[model samples]
Target chain A: MSDIEIKDNPDIKSELQTPPEPGYSEWRKDENTLYNDGLPEEEKDWFCDARPQKARKSVQVIENFLNWARSQSLWILAFGTGCGAIELRPLVTSRYDISRLGMQPRPTPRQANLIMIGGYVSIKTLKRIVRSYEQMQGPKFVVAVCSCAINGGMYWDSYNTVKRIDEYIPVDVYVTGCMPRPEAVLAGFNKLKELIKAGKAEGQNLYIERFDWYKENQKKVIKDWNMPDYNW
Target chain B: METLYKELKQYFDVDEFSVQKASLAFLRVPKSQLVSLLTHMKDIRGYTHLVMVTCVDYLEQDSFLLTYLLHNYSTHCDLGIQVSISRQNPVMDGIHHLWEQGRVYQRELFEMFGIDFPGSPDVHEPMILEGWQGPPPMRRDFDTKAYSEATYSHRPRDHKEPEEYMKQQLYPED
Candidate 1:
């Protein structure tokens, strides 16, 4: 019995009709506005934040299901920039069998949502890493694959290596130790999966939002900057 | 090995020559005869295999010893030809012509020690370190740790977050 119904009208017109409260005028961009208390500058997170985030709420059932599906099936990128990448070999092989957890290494960044930064990033390699990170599709995540990613590990005093990976790019998770064992790698993935299920791992969106800050930090170390504005 | 020593004595003007116990020969030649000696070793002595071209900075002597190591596959003997150049101007003859691989080694030496190889074109190009403005790192006076600290930004030194965390962790009672 789909009967026609009339919905109540919003009271925005009535608010517009009311006069300003005793010299409270502060250059009203929207004259019919209901809320006047602006959010504090400190409350806004775009300034000096580690990563960018957007409030994309999954309201519909289909959107919720899609988010669930994305969490369940993550295509990991096979890009390893350091020596720690050797550890990833055993994880994919018969012994570890990471494929059982619905994670497999994808060759192309465009198809993959997960990137494992498998080692120390030199200034030379940082450029390529930035390009590769940017090339990855949205709803992507980053797992810093070693202690080298944390603080350059053994190459701590070396002039060429970058001490921290987070300064240049946002990392969703960090696998500690010089080279974390296959079990540790799996645990790191499990943690990432938990975050992803909760829709907390939004590094890909964060990168896009705070790209200028990331680019500036990148240019400080990389002197010969000749790539395009956006790598994508 | 004995014949190689004999040839070194006959062909080149040398400061000292000796045969080491471990199937090797050592010849310390003057700075002037470096190129000629290397040419002779390559052309006549059949020590065509260029093992390496390295330098050692002797700060006390105020000179840098440029050593050219050559090996003969047939005889299985190593010969180190040494030439000491002034500390002020450590320049050497580019023997990349005799052994083509010497270009890379000399280029690396040039990058690390500022020992100029005049004829090698790659000496001016960027070798191991790109955009290196500081003094040659391998020199005695060029401090590696100081230069490394000054040139690049490290984590704990630049950001004290980890240090503070460690301090809190180590002294939790405090």
Candidate 2:
């Protein structure tokens, strides 16, 4: 193309930047139609529709529903207080396959639905437990697994452990036994599942009502790590 | 009590001892000799785990009870060693050196019950509280509810209308 002709024809200059339009010549194919040709029928139908459909299914809503369903499947936070926690292994492991019931064990408090207070908790452990409870997200559950959590069992008189865990955080299920058998823990899980199905199992959110309780406990537990420097 | 009976005969100077329950085994030792007994449990009895070390204030008895919950994981035995000390000066030897994890419990006990462990490192610094100068709240003498009430002032429940207050309105009782 001559410089004078290119200067006169703006379309020619634009065509140099992009490939010439397919419809411009008999040799040219339909580019828009060609690009869209590979799309499936359903997607094409969706794109062609003018008015919005009522309550279109979203990836977010689907994911939210899946998460809600999965949350019902409690993930036990591995915060074992004493020997009673040993039985949890059998329930989680091959013997009972607690996973069949959707009760999986998790290491972190953030991911877990249930924080099982196993056996006797020392004031030290109680501090850690309360901190863990605070860290957990909304819709958390507390399962007190032994007589110790209920009444401190054998360590009731000992200055180390609180007789009842209820003094600090709300407990959902109290599984009674000195060292509760694996079957008993499974029963507790079943009970928790029933509660979940019944809509009775909602995440523990007592801190919203009593904010100072957390502050006092945090001061008592996380002494060195204060709120100013630490991430909650 | 078979193990306690045999262990008492083997270790303790006093063979005669009382059994509290089938599960809970307790042995009372002289306050001065508590360290030696703990050391023996650690070295000889293989009760390697120091589950907890706590001080209970027995104000009526005019004494503080120091209890050590020792566990031998191999034998699955829990031992409770108790030593009664005068409440006036609650001092005992620090057992941090015996069990590695005992330092945590010892430090907490020091702060919570105000029990002075002679050789306990880092006992002065607060375990759970920062800038704490008052008597330990866990101590029987320190009433938490009373302390809280004294420390905090309650806000008025009822609100005054700004329009009424702007005029010559007195604070109403009704």
In candidate 1, list every pair of residues with a backbone clash. Answer: A52-A206
lDDT of each: 0.74, 0.64
lDDT of candidate 2 over A1-232, digit per residue (tens): 1331111334423422453222322211332221222235455443322211122223866746654585557787978879878877788678889788767889998888789887887656766787688667656788888887876577634534455576466677889987888888878877876675555654454433333343343444332432221113
Give the TM-score of chain A, superposed on the true chain A, for all candidates in the order listed. Answer: 0.73, 0.63
What TM-score, to 2 decimals, does candidate 1 have?
0.75
Best by TM-score: 1
Candidates' DockQ values? 0.12, 0.03
Clashing pairs in 2: A139-A203, A140-A203
Highest lDDT among the candidates is held by which one?
A: 1
Worst 10 residues of 1 chain A by lDDT: A28-37
User: Each candidate's root-mean-square deviation in Å?
Assistant: 15.6, 23.9
Off by over 4 Å in 1: A1-64, B15-21, B157-174
lDDT of 2 at B164: 57
